[model samples]
Target: MQGFLKVFGHPNPKNPIGYGIDSVFPQLIADAQCLHIVAGRGFACTILIATTSKGAIYFGRLLLGLSNGFLVTFSNIYVSEVAPAYLRGVLVALVSPWVSMGAILGAAIDNATKTRVDKSCYQLPTACLYIVPVLLSVGLFFVPESPRYLLFQRYEAKAKQSLVRVRGELSNQ
Candidate 1:
């Protein structure tokens, strides 16, 4: 598949830019996914905090669902792509467990806060929901692009650097 993409180009000779769609597409999708996740969650937070209209709240719920779907899909793709073969299965398997744990924790919070008469009962949980996206948005700055992604993009040096950033320097025997 990679070889096919590398070899093929648009049939038209007049085209200035052809081939390498595989490279650009993933990068574009990843950037868009990240942006969407952050913005969607931020919008959700606003909707939860300020909106009283049922329509707005419903729209926020829809956005949150879409954002959650994107998060899970992108996370699995990224984990599979970046993980070493030996650890890949284990790492992928752990995602669901973590998500379940989060659900349990969220339920506990909701139970604990349920008794409060004020808006804080629901607002507290909403605030908690905001934390993950905010932290993820900030943490993304320190995370290197997956080496496999860089390689797919034909960035050999960058791929090597990203690999080293993730895996540390390999010692020469």
Candidate 2:
């Protein structure tokens, strides 16, 4: 496994860096599962938006990157825990398609769909990268903040609200 992950942003033997980023993905996503998905999106979007701007995009992007990490880690586990027993499988199942769709979308947008006005292609799957996170975040708004998060946070009202919300949504014929 250790030998396998030496591929991400790996160092080019022909050029300078001693090693490469390698395929650290399995470890990368091991904890959060969605870490790669969200971070890739965040990173792509940050790169695109930052390139056009002049100053201090670095710190902002850094924060976004960190947020991407923390949020995805927190959320994936959060989702699994709060979901009802029967719905647990369904929730985890969602991770697969979302990750795939985001990657595909990023491929499409970054493929060459730059702004019509500028005619410049900033990145591959550019649209998809930016759009994926936004879409996921938006969908998140509809998702209940895990019962565990709320209960642990001691926001009783929210916990109850979450339960009622999911139940209502499910029971609606």
Candidate 3:
């Protein structure tokens, strides 16, 4: 526990961002356990589509769960930050519909591809998860770390650079 906190905890041990990020450990653990149960979700799905019936569905569940988990945190952070206080309630209320819309779109694409439970279809949905890392990298490039975290850590240069990068100008500080 102590070892875990040291790695996941905040620099000052008091900030909300640190606290919230650290809390994600429990969630990440759940995600990892889910991955193990089904085994290489995407890989398994691909195998199932190509080979066996029993193997694919178990892994397909895992792949969907993993994909949803990856995007959920970002949606929380982004919508919370950018939504104005007056309309925050309304904005958040739209989350469910947006998720449904995404699912529909994914289903549309998959259906269009006409992939069967065979290898091709199995690879497609799970393979889509691989792009999450790329999407995350693109998103990360535009997000600045909280000033408090930077100040607590004494990483002024890195913090400032991040600020400039995200805000697109040093004057943003």
Candidate 4:
């Protein structure tokens, strides 16, 4: 298993500088995930406003694609790693429904704006995209780091504290 992980780069390649900024700031991955989402929404909003400029819209869309790819991959990883063991499956399963809800909301917005002849048609829907990422970015600040990540970094006390925070009091359990 260790050999397979090494071959596949499961833990990622070692940096000569000792993990660089990540070592100094443990929340780098989470911050990056939030950044990608916020930036993606920014691109979407920009694309909507650039109705006359096909090139600008196309470039914005390309950036959106890159941001969304990173956002989805990192979000899933973050959720799975951070969730408590007993609730892991439930938390992971909720991801699909959460995504579906966003689609449903977007569709409803599109339906409402379908009759508009002005730029408001796409602009309203695009503007709505900002809500989720903004809320998510703010929400991330309240959550603790993944216990596994803390443990891997040899921060046992912090890992235990994280588990306690996520799982709640031992007496309740």
> Quick one: best TM-score, which candidate?
1
Using Cα atoms with residue i matched to residue i, what is each candidate's TM-score against the true structure? 0.80, 0.48, 0.47, 0.76
* Candidates ranked by TM-score: 1, 4, 2, 3
Please provide, for model 1 over 1-173, each residue's C-alpha lDDT reduced to its tens digit, 9 standing for 90 to 100: 54554565333333344444535566666777787898898888889877778898899889888888888888888788777789999999998998999899999999999999998898888888888898888887777788887986678988988877876884664
RMSD (Cα, Å) for all candidates, in order, is: 4.8, 15.7, 7.5, 6.1
Clashes of 2: 16
Indicate the TM-score of model 1: 0.80
Model 1, position 52: C-alpha lDDT score = 78
Candidate 3: tens digits of C-alpha lDDT, residues 1-173:
34555576546455443342443455456445434433444454455456556655666566656656655654565456545568667877787897788678778767866747655664575466445455544555355554334544456786666555544565432
Give the higher-TM-score candidate: 2 or 3. 2
Better of 1 and 4 by lDDT: 1
Higher lDDT: candidate 1 or 3? Answer: 1
lDDT of 4 at 66: 76
Ten contiguous residues with the weakest lDDT in model 2: 22-31
Please give the ranking of all candidate structures by lDDT, highest first, separated by commas.
1, 4, 2, 3
lDDT, candidate 4, 1-173, per-residue tens? 34533453335446432332334354675567677677676767677566668787787777767776767777788788877678778987887898789899999999999999998898888788778777877887787787888887667888888878977755643
The better-scoring model by TM-score among 1 and 4 is 1
